[model samples]
Target: MPDQDTSDIADIEADIHAHLAEIAEIDAVAVRVYQLRVAHPTDLVAQLAERAGLQVAEVARAERHLARLGLLQPSPGGGWVAVNPESAAESLLAPVEQDILERRITMAATREQLHALSGDYLEARGMRSAKGSIEIVKDLGNIRSVIDDLARTCASSIEVLSPGGGQNEEAMRAALPLDLDVLGRGVRLRMLLQHSARGHRATAQYVETIVAAGAEVRCTGVLPSRMLIYDRHCAVLPVDPEHTGVGVALIRDTSVMGFLGRLFAHYWRTAEDFLADPECDEAAPPEEVGGELRGIERDVLLLMAAGKTNEAIALQLGISRRSVSRLVGRLMDRLGATNRFQAGARAARLGWLASVPPA
Candidate 1:
């Protein structure tokens, strides 16, 4: 048997190793919880747990662990609250502990890749350049920090291609202060958004606010790709949809950034200016608009309300039956109605049909 001191040290080391493994798992969970809180802070813990696929018991455990680490606290009235990093010095792990935790993370990634690929070949191929680093951060807080840092360090301009509306409205709101600070210091901001995004209240508000604060906003029906470029020095791309807890590649190489910048310019040239008053009846002729019901979504709503079946609407509009069905379903969901009649009534009550006169 080992000596008492040696045996004690060995046991402690084993405990540390075990704790390191748990830390990695906890990090992933914490990130997911942070994102949930950012997006839906008013949601109860039970709802958040359900969305995260964690049992209530598991959520309770995680809550306790986070509180103990000083990363979270109970809200004054109810629910758990996140402790901002500015007020979280006590939560910072010791240097040795951090090293051990980081090592465990690297080991976990290595093990996962090795198991999946059955060799080191894929891992080697996937290793990115340290000069131009690519890191996948599953934490929303970390992603926000990275964006802020890039925005601060940008020299000239920042161009963004935003999609899917404002996924993290709170985070975007929080980022306003930082954006204003950057603009105050003379950085130019340019954004390209999907035309449909203007229909989302949160997105429209944010776009208007940013533009009013000196940022340029442009709209386009052709913008399907999401991108963010900083001073033509770095480009950030979403590795995941929902635009939360995703990886961003910080490219410093001029050649790579230049290529991305070219792609951005190409898209920009084809995009429409949101600030410019749209020309009336330019895209579709006035006579053809109502007949085809292509751009006349309101006409489809009206037809659906008239109790016409999908096949009948298709025949009347000279379009595919599938298109009519899809349009009706979309309109119903948009109006938050259970049936065609309810949808039509809701649309009328909301004055959407009245707002857009029949062509």
Candidate 2:
């Protein structure tokens, strides 16, 4: 009966070895050695090799392969033992699954970081031109549209360096509402106009209105160019300084913007306040005034001396025709003159036309 039980155990062991050998990619010698270790849990390499019909070296090699696959382990009694296949698989794959999960988490974090960076990159690209940092905006209307869009988005300040003598009535009418809107939003609006703009009736009224609305205005005899800067990060300049109706250049270059900002600061520091009295004639050096004739009156005298009619003077001065007629009448009364020619001669005699700026 004992011999029969031993025979049954050997048959079972043989069946287990055959099943393990049939598994794909596992060495046959390693399968056999693992079966032997299971049946004789505390057997040394030499005893296991003799029972399995193999040399000690072959048993040792198979033990190494099974140990790497997690199929074998050290016994407490000082030999090798077989591990359960399911436990072995879990032990072999747990660390790999954990590594894969960690990699997936890292990938998600990297994607989030890239998404945030892409938003800033796209915004910066949208603010600049495709050709680079500079863009040429042709046509006066288009330039105004660009400026309008910029004004709406300006966060801190909007600054202008206007070189022409004075704005016309039509231009002032268009600008007033926009300037008031900007000031309404609490934006710092600063304008640098030519000193001669102060003498213009229409321009003075416009300046007065905006000043009351919280704008800063200053005047100088000359300006380098016609420029509009928004928040000091972007600038628009006339393509042709002598004729600004042509086109404009939009600049976003940081170095150029810095230089332009410095230049504007220099001019702003040297310029006089717009509402202040003129320190000197815009057309000539400083001199003492001998009469009550204002700069506008002197302009009228100079135009009349050059044979400009009331219509021409009104058009040049950006004032109404009726205002020019009334002004001519007042000047005639002041000079005690009977006509336009007498008004001019008397103005010259009073030295009023000597420093009058060109119409």
Candidate 3:
């Protein structure tokens, strides 16, 4: 009786192995079936044979066997449809079979290593690296992909230097909310725009929405360029004139990113606060005059009051010294003051130098 029992156990193991092999064969057939279903759902036997790498006669025999087992249904017109078994059976086995086939394909690809070879050749030859990643894309589709990826990956901060009214108001509106969601989770955001951006209704609305959501927005006159920096780790620059497409360089190297971060800071420092409404040039009461100073000029006044020179102020604010001098002249005219000293004195008296919490 014990010998008989051992015999039965060996037979069971053999049957299990045989069933596994059959399933492997069926998995190959399933892949063919999927392709056939896509290309010619009406022609089953040919597709199945092509997929199985078997003769048409052999595939027909296998199909008949599968149909007898109710694993496939024959159509009156032609071809066959898979009749999936109980979910439990498929769930238990199909995934393993599918995974095995995928690994096989991946192995085949790895053996050839065509993609990796191209990437390596590009890196080794240094041709791809020299162009700077942002310049490499040179297409709209690639730009969109890079921007979308950056938006998805940003963890803490996103700084944008946009000129000419900034990324189409509609696109900005859609993207800003996603960035705001990240900011809501404690990420910091800083945006710089061309002063001309103020003239556009879409940009104004976008600025208001972002500022209201607690992101910082600044504007500079005649901004020279556009950029988007994500987490201080990657920077994007527009390659196309229309700015519809851009090139992105992912700066993972700490030194490179640090340099880029400083550049962004330089721009941010000089940018005007967009949260505050600019006061109309028409004269108003002292209260209103102080309110107008609440914008970028007010910050400039405070910096000047600190006894910083025009060059120093320009460096700190990320604008040209000429711009600072221009600002100083405007403030002097506005406050009816003679020099920087008197400008500070008048700004203090008018309460313009008080630290305006970043709106």
Q: Against the true structure, whose TM-score is highest?
A: 3
Clashes of 2: 0
Alpha-carbon shift of residue 51 in model 2 (angstroms): 99
Task: lDDT for model 3, please.
Answer: 0.60
Total backbone collisions, model 3 = 3
> Of the candidates numbered 2 and 3, which has the greater lDDT value?
2
Q: Write the per-residue lDDT of candidate 3 for residues 145-173, one digit (tens) a residue.
A: 77777787788888877766435856776
lDDT of 2 by residue, 1-359 (tens): 45765665466435423333333335567767878898988788899999999999999988887777678887777767888764675565455445445645765676667756744664676686653476667877898899888888888898889876768688679778889999999999989887568767888899999999999998765566888998998999876677787778777878889998888886676566788754332332124234645445555665655456678777665555676677676677777665443455566557665553343
**Per-model lDDT:** 0.60, 0.70, 0.60
- What's the TM-score of every candidate structure? 0.43, 0.43, 0.43
Worst 10 residues of 1 by lDDT: 285-294
Residue-level lDDT of model 1, residues 1-359, one tens digit each, is 13754665456456434433443344556666766765776778799899999887867777777666455777887887787632332233344345445655765676566556523542453475655544444466777788888888888998888764433578678878877887788899888875455555787777777788898877654344578888887777765434435555455656778788887775566556555533232233333422322233555564454345667656554445666667676666666555443454456555554432211
Error (Å) of candidate 3 at residue 196 is: 1.7
Q: How far is candidate 1 from the true structure (C-alpha RMSD, Å)?
A: 23.2
The regions of model 1 sitting more than 4 angstroms off are 1-130, 276-359
